[model samples]
Each structure stands twice: as C-alpha cells, then as structure tokens.
Target: MTIDALRHSPEQLRARIAAELERARNRSTGLTDAVDGDDLVRQHSPLMSPLVWDYAHIGSQEELWLVRDVGGREPVRPDIDNIYDAFQTKRADRPSLPMLNPDEARVYVSTVRDKALDVLEHTPLEGRRLVEAGFAFGMIVQHEQQHVETMLATHQLRQGPAVLDAPAPPPGAPAAETEVYVPGGMFLMGTDLDPWALDNERPAHAVGVEPYWIDTDPVTNAQYAQFIADGGYADRRWWTPEGWAHRSNAELTAPQFWHDDGTRTRFGHVEPIPPDEPVQHVCWYEADAYARWAGKRLPTEAEWEMAARYDPESGRSLRYPWGDEDPTDEHANLGGRYLQPAPVGAFPKGTSPLGVRGLVGDVWEWTSSDFTPYPGFAMFPYPEYSEVFFGPDYKILRGGSWAADPAAVRATFRNWDYPIRRQIFSGFRCARDV
Candidate 1:
C-alpha cells in the first residue's frame, strides 16, 4: 500500500502507539533493568539501553515527531538529533557514547507517552486510519525488537545464551547430493512503494526464471564427505576460474571445521560423526563446489523464497514450517539450547504447508542474490543500516542461526557475509530444473 493512505492524524496515532508501548514495557524486551531501588550506577546495559534509556528514547522519539513536528510544541530534548536517527548513527562515530542515565531516559519515554496520550484525546477521528498509525507505531516496536536482540548479542560473550545446536546425524546414511529446483515463472518480487522498500528492493520489478529442482535442505557433512571422497576438491575442472583461484590462495581442501571425527560440535559433545547435520562453516566457494559436483545450482533469493513456500502436505503460508507459533524447545533447532545441528527431517510438525521444513529457524540459508535492498527501500534513517553493504559481492542469507535471537529469524530477515570466508555458522541449500 502507498504512504499517503497510511499516514494517520496525530490523536489516533497516539492511542495506537500507547497500547504497543505498554506491551513492550511489560516484556523483558531483551534489555534487563536493575532491581528497583538498587543503587547501582549502571541501571541498564549500554550495549542495550537501561530501563530509563529505552523508556526515554522511545518517548523522545514521540516528542520529536508528534509534539514538535506534528503538534508544534518546542522540543523537550533538542539533542534527540544526536541519538535517534537510525540511518545517521551507522555512518558516524558514536558507537562508544555513554548515553543518558536511567532516570533521565525513563523521564523522556514517560513524558512522550503522557504528552502523546493527551494530544490524542483531543485529536479528530474522521479521516484517521489505524493502518498508518499502526505501521508507524509498529516501526517503533520493531526498532525496540532490534535493540532487544542487540542487547542479547552484546552480552553473548558473558552470561548470554550459547550458540545453536543441531541434532545428531542419521546412522549409516551415505552422504547425499543436494539440488535446487529452478522454478521458471514470472514470480512477483519486491514491494512496490514510492518510498516503500529500501533502495535495492525497490524498482518493484518482475524477473522471468527458468523452472528447476533444488535440494530440500542445506548440504550436510554426510554430503560433503562424498564430495571430498569423489575428488570434488582435488580437481579444477569443477571450479570456476575465480573460485579455483580463491581455493588455491587459501590452500584449503575440505570444509573449515573438517577434522578427524571428534571435533567439538556447536552442540555439547564431540561428534561421534553425525553426517546428516547440515554442513556448517563452508564459504560460498565450498557451497558452489558442492553444487557443481552434484550437477545443481544455488537458488536466487527470489527462488529460495518461492521454494521455502513449497509445502507438500498443505498449501498455505505458515509463519514457520512447524506452524504459526514462535519456536519452542521441541521445534526447529533454535535458541542454541541444543548447541548443534539436528538431523535433517527431525522436525515434522514444523514443516510448512508445502512440506518444506526449517525455513524460519535453523542455520541461515545462503542465496545467490547479493545482499541488496528491495524496490522502494528507504534507509531506516540510520546511515550505516543499508548503504554500507550495497556492493555486488556480499551474498544474502535467509532464516536465523541456532544461536541467533529468535526474534531475528523472521521469514524476511536477511543476513549476508563475504563469499570467500565461511564462519562456523554459514551453510546452504541447492536448486535445479525439473
């Protein structure tokens, strides 16, 4: 939908935002607050805001926009320009700022809430739409969601949750080749807003693709073993010139974590050799090699999204393959509480309507598309958000890793990394034509 139809009157916006703000405040929100009345100097995390910072930051945001811009009141804190701009922050040198104290911060958020409500009570209701107000308020909530995870990530080195774990490999199953299905069709891609999507996702255009088959899941260790055994790495014929050059330069023969059977897995114990656990830590070169050795190819972001929609059992868009609920301990290998990859086909209930499972939570799936914005992408006002990574090289990955915050694993959240280096967490699925 267009932005014009989305904007709301100031009063209606306030009431809608108030409900969301309360919901977020009640939740742990990824940012833990100090015990009430405790005299600790640091009331909240600088990595995440303290209780005061979050409340004030959110409130200041309302004040800047609603009171000052919309309602025309002078700003309570004109310095908001220093902290809030999402796009600008990324481009500057403020990553180390010791921000506002808890008390002052909360005052800001609370003040905004109070003033926002007061203004809304007298606002006109005739032409205001909840949709626009919802989107705006939702943006604020989503911004909070980001901090919630950021706070978790910054604390990962401390008492934060451990990395995600996978299920043990199936016993005695020979390593299998993976494939990608090439769906040749005029598929609808990108959101069409005049200022709707980020710059890259925009130019809302359609691409004609050829139909093909892709692997249902990412290539696992069992599959990689066969590639090595079949001399996939030793031969240069299977590699592209650039791919071969990279391989030679790195002096690499096998996947990054490949050692003699008992390596410490992302899961708790040493591997007795779980072959079905999706192979982790391989770079784009390795994934491409595996695809080449198997006579298939990697799917583009569009293709990957389309295949992710495939459900052999049902025909609907489910939030997760397991269904529309947030992941639980028994669902896909998430929260890293398991500490490693699960065997393929482990979560039956998590399968999508088309029988495609693990699309939402698992090792992030790499796609052929470079990490670029969609049509109509508007930078989130944070300079470092989108412009820093528009180069042609960075690859796009979907889904969230086991250790990634569950909130980060939404169907649309994209991840990217360079092609030559494979971290312990990266992996991929393949695609081919029928």
Candidate 2:
C-alpha cells in the first residue's frame, strides 16, 4: 500500500491512537524508578533526544498544534509553552528545556495523554477534519518509535549489554553474502507530497545517478575497527573538511563506545562490541570515513531506496522495498523486543529483493543526500518541521534502528541529522559502481 492509503479518518485515527495509548500505558514499565535518568536521556546521540521527555514532548505538541489550537482552546498551561517544543531546540543538554523531576514529568505526560484522549471522545469524528489524523498519528507513531530507540540506546549506553530477544536467523542463514547489484535508472526520489516529513526531507526532487552495487550487510564493528587500526581516523585524506574538524574538536579517533580491548563498552556498568554484531553509535562522519578508507562511498538516498525497493514488476516508486505493507518482524529488525541490532545475515526472509538484509531496520543508514525540499513542497501546517532545516548542515538518513516499531518502518520514512554527530543507531553501508 502507498503512504497515501495509510491515512485514517479523524474519528478512526483518534480511536486508534487512544487504543494504542492505552496499550502503551498498560504495557510500558512506565518510569517507576529513575536510576537511569542520565541513561534515559540520549545525551550522546545527536540523532536522538532524551527518553525522559519524548512522549510528553510530542504528546504535548499534538495538543497545542492539533487539538487545542484547532479547537480554539488557548493553552491552559503557558509554563509548558516552550517546555515540550522540539523543532525550536538543539541538543537537550543545551538547557533548552527545564528538567522535571519524575513526578512532574509524569503528571505532565498524563495530562497530555488524557487531554488527547478526551478530545478523541468528545470531538465529533465527522465534520471536515481540521488536520489529517492519519498524518498526525504517523507523527505520533514516529515520535514514540524514536523514543523507544533513544531508550534502547540509553539502555545500551548506560547498561552495557543489550537486552536479548528471540533468536534471529542463524548466522549465514542468508549467507555471509556478496555485493548486490542494483540496476539504477530514473526513479521518483522523495515524497514531495508526503506531508509528514521533517524540514530536511523537503524538496523531494528528482536526482539522476548511475547504477551501483551496495553491500548486502551494514558495516559491522569488526569492520569499522579495521579502519581505526589502519589509521582511518588519523588520516586527513580519509575525512572531509567538516569531518576532520569535528574529529579534531572531539578528539575522537574511534567509535564513541569503543574501548581499548576494542570489543566492549562500560554501559551503566557492563562491557562492548561482540566481534560479529553490527556496530552501533557511529556518526555520519565516521561512516563516511570508513567508506573512504575502504575505497568506496556511502549510498545516495536514491540508490539505497532503489535497492531496498527492488521488484522488476512493481517498480521502485513503491513506498517500501518489501511491497507497501506496513512492517512486521517478518520484514525488518525493528521493535525493541529484540532490544539490539541482530547479527548480519540473521533475517533471510527480511532481505530486499536485491538480497540486502536489514534495509528497513537495525541501524539508521546514513545517506549521501543532503536534506532538501521537494519541488513545490509545503510543510503540513506544522510550520517548524520542514522549514527550519533548509540550511546546508543536515544530511538525510533512511531505515530505522532496532529500537523503532516495526510498523513504523515504511520505505518512505525520512530522517536527517548533522554529519558530525555520532550516536548508537546511526551507521551506514558502502556503495560502488558495478
């Protein structure tokens, strides 16, 4: 199904969101303790925000933008005016928001959730919808999925080993693999008409490029360490000017969580990478450096999507590579139930038709495309979203991390971040000309 079909009517969407919220409120452990406060906030990942604030942040936002404002109710709590806003903010530690004790934060979250639910119950589902609920629900789902990711990253960052889950396919179930070739050609690039994208995904214009080959698997920790041992981090020739400057400033010569023994990190109080696992926490700059050191380059967004959407009969214009179906574990490594990036070759059934595994999940893939707008693009009444990042800094990334909800992993989900930042969920794959 196309993204356009997922749009739900106002009443139906609200009912679904309310039901989903009930499930979440029932299922989640729900911050009963705060020992992991620092861990809960994804302070180290520029690609993520602190978990303590995510739901309330966006839930509160939907109220202001979608419900309250739409219904003509002035905000009841002006103190919250800027507290939950994300579009105007930068890093969480930059003091953009006041830190709330767990209690105040809980109260704030409850109020927002309840208010949205109340609106759903009271507002007539019928009249011309003020905003598209499906799109709004998509934003909520995306926002929550990002938090679960931040939480997983926080768990790994603070707790060391990831929480385990049902075993994925045996190693090499899909073979250790070889470079898969994508016969590229003219393709529609972005959802210029997709109303839900962030500012960086705007101006979804057509981009022409030649066909190329991309690795069937994402770059693993063992592979990245080889770059470091080869002085990939130390060499100026391997890095772009911005990347070099960033490395110089951060004094980062290895992955953020890399340790001397080189295998494990001390999350919360544990250890680091297993030789076979896919790497986590590397930034876009690091991915680029590794690609350069390996004598290759990161995939352009178009090439990445083209491979992921392989189907000679269906065409790459389809929303996701695995047909247009909303994702399930059968399709990707999403949802935190696994709680970690699986070993490469673990999901044979999940591979793109081109035989690329983990295209929809595992780690968010850094793309060579710049975050730009589609032709004749306009933000979906959420003014700050696509208009804010029209600047030159942000770069596009695709796929979702292991922490995201599988249902949220559409081929069209667009994410963007500055290249210099490093966090656990952002890593990349290599592409070269056939």
lDDT of 2 by residue, 189-243 (tens): 6654554444345455565658788988888878888888888878999899988
Model 2: lDDT equals: 0.65
Off by over 4 Å in 1: 1-183, 190-207, 265-273, 310-331
For model 2, the superposed segments whose C-alpha errors exceed 4 Å read 1-14, 22-55, 71-74, 87-99, 122-130, 154-176, 192-207, 266-269
Candidate 1, residue 351: lDDT: 52
Q: Write down the TM-score of every candidate.
A: 0.61, 0.84
| Model 2 poorest 10 in a row by lDDT | 26-35
Measured by TM-score, the strongest candidate is 2
lDDT of 2 at 276: 58
Kindly give the number of clashing pairs for every candidate: 71, 17
